[model samples]
Target: MKIRKANQNDLDEILNLFTDTISEVNNRDYSPSQIKAWSSSSKDTDRWLLKIREQYFLVTEEEDCITGFASITNEGYLDTMFVHKNHQRKGIAKTLITALIDYAKENQLKEIITDGSITARPFFEKHGFKVIKKQMVNRKGIEIANYKMKKLL
Candidate 1:
């Protein structure tokens, strides 16, 4: 798999990856309504473009298909990170996070933080992120549970 910076052309694939991974990988932990509320697959091109431009989004692809993605901010907030459901536990997430961590180090970021879903918290924990708190966040009037996790550089 090759990890590369995202371009405008990758929007559709990115959105699909996000939605599919959320539904398939998170269904075991989240309710149907919660997943729908969270992913909300309605394509908002402008919003996605903004994320692509500002978040320094990156994607990993194999056989011309996107396998995973991760994005981070200058402030070291890991805004988005997802691996295709079928590609989980294959070091994709780790590779994504490792790239972000390297970026954080180069940019002098002191730590990295993210609100991780139940399905993702364990993965982050394995990467040295500790849970700061558990939170109930509302999305589309649906309450969803998550953990605010952080890792010191």
Candidate 2:
């Protein structure tokens, strides 16, 4: 697999991966309603375009197909991190996070923060992030639980 910065051309693939991962993988931890609400954000094209255009977004591709994607803001806010549902446990997420962390360190960021879903809490913890609090985020009127986590770079 190859990892590189995301471009405008990668938007659709990234959105599909994000929605699929939440619908399939996260469904184990979140209810169906929550999954639908969360995945619905994929339709927000403008928001996604801003991330791809402005953030340190990266995507992993294997055989020309996107397998995973992640992004971090200038302030070290980890806004998105998702591996294709069929590609879980294959180190895609680890590679993505490692690259994001390296970018953070190079940028002289003091820390990295993220709101991780219940299904992703363990993965974030394993990467040296600690939960600051468990918070409920409302999406489309559905309250979903996630952890506010941070890692000092």
Candidate 3:
């Protein structure tokens, strides 16, 4: 697998990966209703596109297909990380996070933060992030619980 900066062409695939990952991999930790409300493709497409355009987006590709993606915004103040379900546990997220951290360092960012799902909290913690709080974010009137995690750069 190769990791590189994301381009506009990668947006659709990245979005699809994120949607599928949330519904499948993340479902183990989040209820179906919460997952559906939080990651609904309809609401996320525009947001994903905006992030891809405005943030430092990176993608992991294998055989010309996007396998994972990550985005850091506000000079790394916020981040969104996702890996294709089929590519999970294969170091794809590690590569994506490494790239985001490098981007943050290059930008001289003081910190990085993310609202991490239960499936992702351990990964963030393992990567030096500390939980600042447990969050209950409502999406489409459905309560979705997550952790507010931050890492000092």
Q: Which ranges of candidate 2 are over 4 A from the true structure?
A: none
TM-score of each candidate?
Answer: 0.97, 0.99, 0.94
Q: Report lDDT per candidate.
A: 0.93, 0.96, 0.85
lDDT of 1 by residue, 95-128 (tens): 9999999999999999999999999998999999
Q: Look at candidate 1 and tell me the lDDT of residue 112.
A: 97
TM-score winner between 1 and 2, please give it. Answer: 2
**Could you give the C-alpha RMSD of every candidate to the true structure, in order shown?**
1.0, 0.5, 1.3
lDDT of 1 at 113: 94
Residues 79-123, candidate 3, lDDT per residue (tens digit)?
678889998899998988888888889888889989888889999
Candidate no. 3 TM-score: 0.94
Off by over 4 Å in 1: none
Instruction: Give candidate 3 regions above 4 Å deviation.
Output: 41-44
- Looking at model 3, the pairs that clash are none
For all candidates, the clash counts are 0, 0, 0
Candidate 1: TM-score? 0.97
